[model samples]
Target: MTQTVDLNADMGEGFGPWPMGEDAALLETITSANIACGAHAGDWDVMAGTMALATERGVGIGAHPGFPDLQGFGRRRMQMPHDSLRNLVAYQVGAARGMAASVGGTVRHVKLHGALANMASEDAAMAQACYEGALSVDPDVIIMVLAATAQQEAAQALGCRWAAEIFADRAYNDDATLVDRRLPGAVIHDPEEAGARMVEMVQAGAIITASGARIPTPIDTICLHGDTAEAVGIARATRAALEAAGIALGVFPGRR
Candidate 1:
């Protein structure tokens, strides 16, 4: 079992006057923040506010770049040329890096969001394009990849600094892909249940699938969604559970 791990959550996903997620409350429990860029959700003000809060809390800040699908919250799949995908990621990541720097913080890592992430998790070429784009902007920035997926494969091929992440509130299929959100029992809502699952996965050093399959992989971080009150509770509980299990929670040491 890994002795240390990082907890991260997606935040700053609001646009204009609209708000999404309990970012402030989530920040109290997570060690890293993946702030949304304008392409999917969030504007300059939202990004700045999120970055400031993360800086104040002494948490690692990361860019969460996704497709330009604000209406779908970037969850709708879209096909595009690999070069365009690269440019898209680069633009969002650069914007996030600047926002963080303006607030006396820096983007320590980059994580793909929504459909882009889902697509990349299965397409090594796409994942590589996205990571290369991020690296082009800042070679030192860590790439946070979904553990045991093509996202991890791309990062390994690039030989760049990276972190492996697993979902704390989502069910995984036998193939390590997330179960469709519309499916029954796809998203775990109970705090205790989420917490216990996280502890079990960390201890087992693998992702326990919905059908009880365990796929071993490096678990550098656990991802929690902050889009709802229940998610915030789960985040807190998961942090406590890890602590109780003697696992230190902190910013991940980007791939050794």
Candidate 2:
């Protein structure tokens, strides 16, 4: 089992007027913050504000780019050519970098958001395209990818800096994909349940699927979705649980 891991959360998802998630509270609990770019949910104001806040908290900033579906909160899937997907990712990541720079922070990582991420997890070609876009912007930027999926495969194939990630608030399929949101028990709302599962999975150095199967992998970081209603509680609980188990939390030292 790894002695240390990084805790990250999605943030900066709010648009101009309507805010989303508890970024303030979640920042207090997480070591890394994945801020959404404009095409997905955040606007320039939100991105700049979130970037400044993350800088103040000394949290590692990540560029989170999703499909341009603000109405769907980037949760709705979209079909696009690989070239378009790559360009989309590049644009978002570039924006994130510029915003972070203005805020006296830096984007150290990149994470695909919503449906785009889900799709990438299943398609190496697609994942490769997004990653290529990010790398074009900053080859040193760490790609945080869903472990044991095509996302990871893409990163490894590219030989770029990357981190393997697992969810703290979501259940995993036996094949290592996330269970669909439409499915019952797909999203774990209880802090205790979420925290306990994280501890177990981290200790096992694998993803413990809903079917009770374990898929071995190096666990570099754990994700807690900030949009979840129980996000704050789950974040706190997960941090405490990992600490109690003698696993330190800090920024992930991305792998090659």
Q: What TM-score would you give candidate 2 relative to the actual structure?
A: 0.99
Per-residue lDDT of model 1, residues 163-249, tens digit only: 999998999999898998889999999999999999999999999999999999989999999786798889989999999999999
TM-score on alpha carbons, each prediction: 0.98, 0.99
By lDDT, the best candidate is 2
* Model 1: colliding residue pairs: none
lDDT of each: 0.94, 0.95
Q: Which residue ranges in model 2 land beyond 4 Å of their true spot? A: none
**Candidate 2 local lDDT, 1-256, one digit each (tens):** 5499999999999898999999999999999999999987999999999999999999999999999998898989999999999899999999999999998999999999989999999999999999999999998999999999999999999999999999998999987999999999999999999999999999999999999999999899999999989999999999999999899999998998
Global CA lDDT computed for model 2: 0.95
